[model samples]
Target: MISVEGVAIDTRHWIGGRRVASDRTFADISPIDESFLGDIAAGTAAEVDAAVAAAREAFPAWAALSAPERGAILRRVADGIDERREDLARVETRDNGSLLRSHRRGVMPRVAMNFRFFADYAEKLAHPDMEIRGHRERVTYDPAGVTAIITPWNAPLMLATWRIGPALAAGNTVVLKPPEWAPLTASLLADIAHEAGLPAGVFNVVQGIGAEAGAALSKHPGINRLSFTGSVPTAGVIAAAAAPTIVPLSFELGGKSPLLVFDDCDLDLAVDLAVEQFDNAGQVCLGAFRILVQESIAAEFQARVVEKARGLVQGDPRDEKTDVSALVSRAHLDRVSGFVDRALADGARAILGGAAPEKGLYYPPTILADAKPGSEILTEEVFGPVLTFQTFADEDEGVRMANDTRFGLAATLVTGSPEKAERVSARLNAGTVWVNCFFVRDLGAPFGGNGKSGIGREGGTYSFDFYCDVKNTVFSPNGWKESSHG
Candidate 1:
C-alpha cells in the first residue's frame, strides 16, 4: 500500500459517500519504472449490486432538484478538481504511464473543464412548449434513472468525468466503474465529489476487473443507461449483457483513423500531425494509424514523417523532457510489438522504430513503409506508437482509403486548398474531421463515432439528450379552437 501524509491510503469502493472495503485487493504498478504504486479494492458482483441499489435509492431526490441547483453542485466539483490539479495529475501519470507534461497541461485541465462546462450547460437546458392547433404541447427531459459509466485506463479520471458530469447535470445518478489498472484517481474523485457537496449516493465508484464488476454493472436491471469507452470487443460483451435489460447504451470504442496528406499541404505541419500517432505512446483512440499521402508527394512526406518520428524523445513519463513514455503495461507493450513483427513478416518495411527497448515497457515510435491496404497492421488498432504509410493516386482514392476502416471515430485531412478541405470533410466517414489540425477538441461539439467506433454521441447537447429521457405531453384546453384551413 502507498502512504500519504504518514497515513496509509485505503483503496476501496466508494459507495454512499463512504469508502467500503472488499475481501481482496489488486496491486497497481507504474509502467514507467515498474514501481508498485498501490492496491485497489477488487469489487465483485455483490459490490456492484450494493452500489446500484444506493444509486436507485438516491435517484428521486437528486432528480427532484432544480437544474440550477444541480449545476451549482457540479460547478463546485469542477472547482474541487482544479484545486487538487497537481495531485490528480501526478496520480494519473503514475497510474497510467502518461507523460507528466500531458497530465498537467492537457488531461487534468480537461477533467475540470468537463465538469464546469456541464455545470453551466445544465442551467441552459430547456424543454420547449408550443401551441399546435390551439392545443398545448409540452416536452420534458427527465433523468434516466441510474447510469453505468465504464471508463478505459488510458485517461481514466478525465473520461469518467466526461460521462459523470453530464449524467449528474441531467439529474441522473451514476455508478462509475474505473479501469482496474488505474483506479486510484477515480477513487480520489469520489472523495472530491463528496467534498464538493454532492449528495450521498449520487455518484459512486466501484473498482475491479471488467469480467466481474463491469459485467455486473452492465447486467444490472436497475441501470437505465450505460456509457462505455473502451475496445470494440469488450463493448460487444457489454452490449450483449445489457441486452437482457433492454437498457439504452452509449459506446465510444476503438478507432483505426486515417490522416490524408495532399501534395498541396504544408509539409512541416503535415509531418507534425503525422507524428501525433506517437502521442500518448499512440494509446489515443483517435490517433491516426494510417497515413494516406497523395502519390505526387508521397516520398517526400514519408521521409519527413520518419525523420520527425525518430526525433521524438522516449524515456520516463515523469521526466518533463520525455516526449513519449512507456505503454500502460508490459502485456500491452508485447501486444503492440507483436503487431509490428507481424507487419514486417508480411513484407512491410520499417522506416524507423520496429522494436521494444531491452529494459522497460517501452516500444519505440515505429513507422512502416509499403504497408498494404488490407494488411493487419494497417487495419487493426495497434494502440501503440506505430504508423503505417500508404499511397493514393488521386483525391477520390485518398478519401476511399481513409474510410476503409471498420472504425471511424475520427479522421484528419491536410490540404492547402479550401475547396478540397470542404469537399473531403463532407465525404469522410468519421465523427470528427480535422482539416489541417489533429485532436483539436471543442467541449461544445458532438464527439462520438459511426459504425463500430461507437453507437451514439457524447458532447454538448448530445450528452444531455443521451443521459436523460425526453417525454412529450399534449393537453386540450376546455375551449380550444381549431385552426381554419381553406
Candidate 2:
C-alpha cells in the first residue's frame, strides 16, 4: 500500500481476482509538481506467466457465458465506473498530469461509455449462415483465448477500457499492462471489475516498465492476441516479440496528423481548432502537429493561432483554469523542448512559446513557423504542445502537403462546402478524417491509422472482430457426393 496526498492506494497487481505482491516496486510521481503519488508493483516475466496461465485457466468458463450474460456484467462495470467517476478522474489527473476538469467532464464519461457501448454491441453481433444449391454454410465467432492489452500513458483508463470492453465482450480473458507512467487508474479499474462480479482471471493487470512487463506479455506463448497503443518503435518491438508464435497483433501507434485550414472556412473556428493542438498538452496521438493553411488567409490565421496559444494558461493540472499542464515526466518535457530547439536550428521560426517553464515539467503551447516540409518537427511526431505552420496556394497543394508525412493516423479539414469536404476527405490517406471540427469522436465508428500510424481498426464491430476469431462450417445435402475428382 502507498499513500497519495493522504489517500492510501493499493498498488498491487490484480491477478486471479486478487491483489498480488511483487518483489520490486516503482514510484508513481505526479508530473504536476513532481510529487510522489504512490508505489506501483514492478511486474516481471514471472508475473506475466502467472497472469497468462490464470487467463488460460479461466477461458473456457468465461467464454461459456452467453453474450447477453457477459454484456450484463460489462454494463455493471460501466455503472461502477460512473459511480466512481469523480474519484477515477482525480486519480487520473494526479497520475498523468491531465487537467482535472477535462478528466471529470470528458475522459471519465468516455471511459464509462466505452464499456456501455461494447456491452450493447455484444448482443447485436451476428454470424450469419448461408445456403447455396444443395450445400449449407454456417459462420461462428469464438473468443481469441488469452489476450494482452498494452496501453499508453496518456488517458490511461480510457484507452484501457477502449480495448478491455470489447475484449471482454467478445468473451476473451485479458491480461493488461498499463503504462508505468500512469498505472493508478488501471489498478482501480481492476478493483471495480471485481466488485462488478467479473470472474477470477477474467481480467488481470500487471504494472511495470515496458521492457519487463510489456515484453513479457507480448512474447508470452499463452497469449493468443496482443493489442497495443504506443510509439512506432515500441510497436516494432512488440511485433518482433510476438512474431515467433505468429500471434495476432493489433496496434494503434504514433501520428504526425495534419489539420488543413481552407480559405473558405470560418477563420475563428479554424483558429480554435488550431489552438486545440495543445489539448492534453498535445500528448495525444491524434493531435495536429502540422497546420496547413491557404495562402490567402495564412497570415491572419497564423496570427490568430499564435494569440490563442499564447493566452492558454499553463499551471497545475488540478486547477480548472489551467489549459495546459505538465508533460508526463521531466524526460518527456525535455524531449518536447528538444524538438523545438532542433527545429529552430533547422531554420524554423518559433512564433510563440519557444522555451520550457522555469520549474516543473511544463512546456508552454509552442508554435513554429517556416518549418521546411521534410524537417524533423514537421514530419516526425513531436507529441507535445507544439504545432508547425505551413501555407499552400491551392486546394491541391494543401492536400498534397497533408499527405506528405509517413504517418496517416488522422487528419482534419476545415471547409464550409460539403463538396470540397468530400473531395478533400477522400484524398487524405489517414484512417480518420474530421471536417470543420477536431477531436469529435463516435464510439461506433472505426478508429486507428494507416501506414506507420498503426495496423487494424478499433471501435464497435471492428474491436469485436479483432478480439474474436471466426470459423466457417460447410455441409453437403448428399453426404458422400463431394468426391467428384476421386
Candidate 3:
C-alpha cells in the first residue's frame, strides 16, 4: 500500500464529499510498467449506495442553485484545477501511462477548459420554444433528480468533467464512477471540486469495478439517469442492468471513426491530423482510427504516414521528449496484440508497429494497409496508436467507405471544394463530421451518434432534454399530469 502524508492513502473510497473505505482494496500500477502507483479501496454495492444516497440527499439543494450560481462555483473549481495543474497532470500521466507532455500540455488544459466552458454555458441554457399545442399548453426542461457518470480510464479526467460539467451546471447532482483502472485521478478531481465550494454530496465519486460498483450505480434506485462512456459490451451490460429499474441511460460507446482524405486534400495536413487523432496511444473513443484515402494519392500518403508514425518516440512516459507511451495494462496490450495477429491473418499488412514492445506495454505506432472491408481490425475498435487505411476510387466510394461501419460516432474529411466537402459530410453518417479538423467539441453542440454508437445527445444546450424528465401539462389551456389532483 502507498502512503500519502502518512494517512494510509492506500485504502481509500470517495463517499459523501470525502474519501472513505470499508475493508477491500487493490493495488494500482503505472501503465508504463508494473510499478506500484498506489492502492485504492474497492467499494462494493453498499458503498455505491452510499454515493447514490449522498447524491440524492444533495440533489434538491444543487438543483435549486441558479444557473449562474452553479456556474460561478464551477468557474472557481476550474480555477482550482488550474492551480494544481501540474500535480493533476502528473498523476494522470503516471496512472494512465499516457505521454506526460501531452497530459500536461494537452489533456489537463482541455479538462480545465471543459470546466470553464460548462460554467459559462450553463448560464445561457434556455428552454425550448414553449408553444401551445392541441389540448396542451407547452413544454419545458427540468433537472433530473440524480445523475450517474460512468467514465472510462483512457481519458478519465477529461470525460468525467465532460459528463459532470453540464449536468452540474443545470443543477443535477452527480455520482461518478471512474474506471477502476485509474481511480485516483477522479478521486483527486472530486477533492478539488469539494474545495471549490461544491456542497457536500453535490458531486460524489465511488471506486469499484464495472461489475460491482458500476452495476450498482446503473441499477441504483435513486439515480435518475446514467451517462456512460466506454466499450459497446459494457454498454450492453449497462442496458441490461438498468432494465429492472427502467431508468434513462445515456451511452457514448465504441467508435471506429474514419478520416476520408480525397485527392484534393493537402497530404501533409491530412497526415498530421491523423497522427493527432491516434495520439496518446489511440485510446480515445473518438480517435480517427480508420483512414480511407483516395487511390490517386494512396501510395504517397501511405508512405508519408508510415514515416511519421515511425518517428514517434516510444519510451518512459515521464520523459518530456517522448511522443507516445505504453498501453494501460498488460491485459489491454494482450488484447491489442491479439487483434494485430487477427489482422495479419486476414492479410492486412503492417507498415509500422504490430507488437507490444519488449520493454513496457508499448505498441509502436503502427500503420496497416490493404485491409479488407469487414476485417476484424477494420470493423472493430482498436484503441491503440495503430491506424488502418484503405483506398477508394471516387468521391462517392470514399463517402460510402467512410460510412460502412456499424459505429458512427465521428468522421473527418479533408477536401478543398466547398461543395464536395458539404456533400460528403452530409452523407458520412456520423454524429460529428469535421471539414478540416478532428476531435473538436463545442460544449453546446449535441453529440450522440446514430446506430450502435449509443443514444442521447451530450454537450451543447440540448443535453438537458436527455438528463431531465418532462411533464405534459393541459388544463383549460394549462394543466399537468404530475400535479396534485384537481
lDDT of 1 by residue, 108-165 (tens): 8999998889878888877678998888898877888999999999899989999999
Higher-lDDT candidate of 2 and 3: 2
lDDT at 71 for candidate 3? Answer: 88
- Candidate order by decreasing TM-score: 2, 1, 3
The reply for model 3, stretches above 4 Å from the true place, is 1-11, 128-139, 470-486
Query: Which stretches of candidate 1 lie above 4 Å from their native place?
Result: 4-8, 479-486
lDDT of 3 by residue, 1-486 (tens): 354222223347667777777687777877877688666777788998888888889889888888888889999888988987787777778788877787778788888888788778767655554455545344555788889999998988988888788788778888888888877778777778888999999988788888888988888888888899989999998998888888888899988988899999888899898778657788887888898899999989988888787777877888987888888988898898888888988898988777667767888888888777788998998898878988899998888889889998899999888999989988989888888887776677888887778887887666667776655554364455676686
**Count of backbone clashes, every candidate in sequence:** 0, 0, 7
Evaluate model 3: give its lDDT: 0.82
* Residue range with the least summed lDDT across 10 consecutive positions in model 1: 1-10
lDDT of 2 by residue, 1-486 (tens): 765544456899999988998999998899989988877899999999989999999999999999999999999999999998888888889889999999889899999998889878888888677999978899777898998999999989999999999999999999999999999988889988999999999999999999999999999989988999999999999999999989998999999999999999988899998998899999999998799999999999988888778789989888889999989999998899889999999999989988878888988888889887688888889888998889999999999999998999999999978999999999999999999888887888899999999999988788877899987889888857566776
lDDT of candidates 1 onward, in order = 0.90, 0.91, 0.82
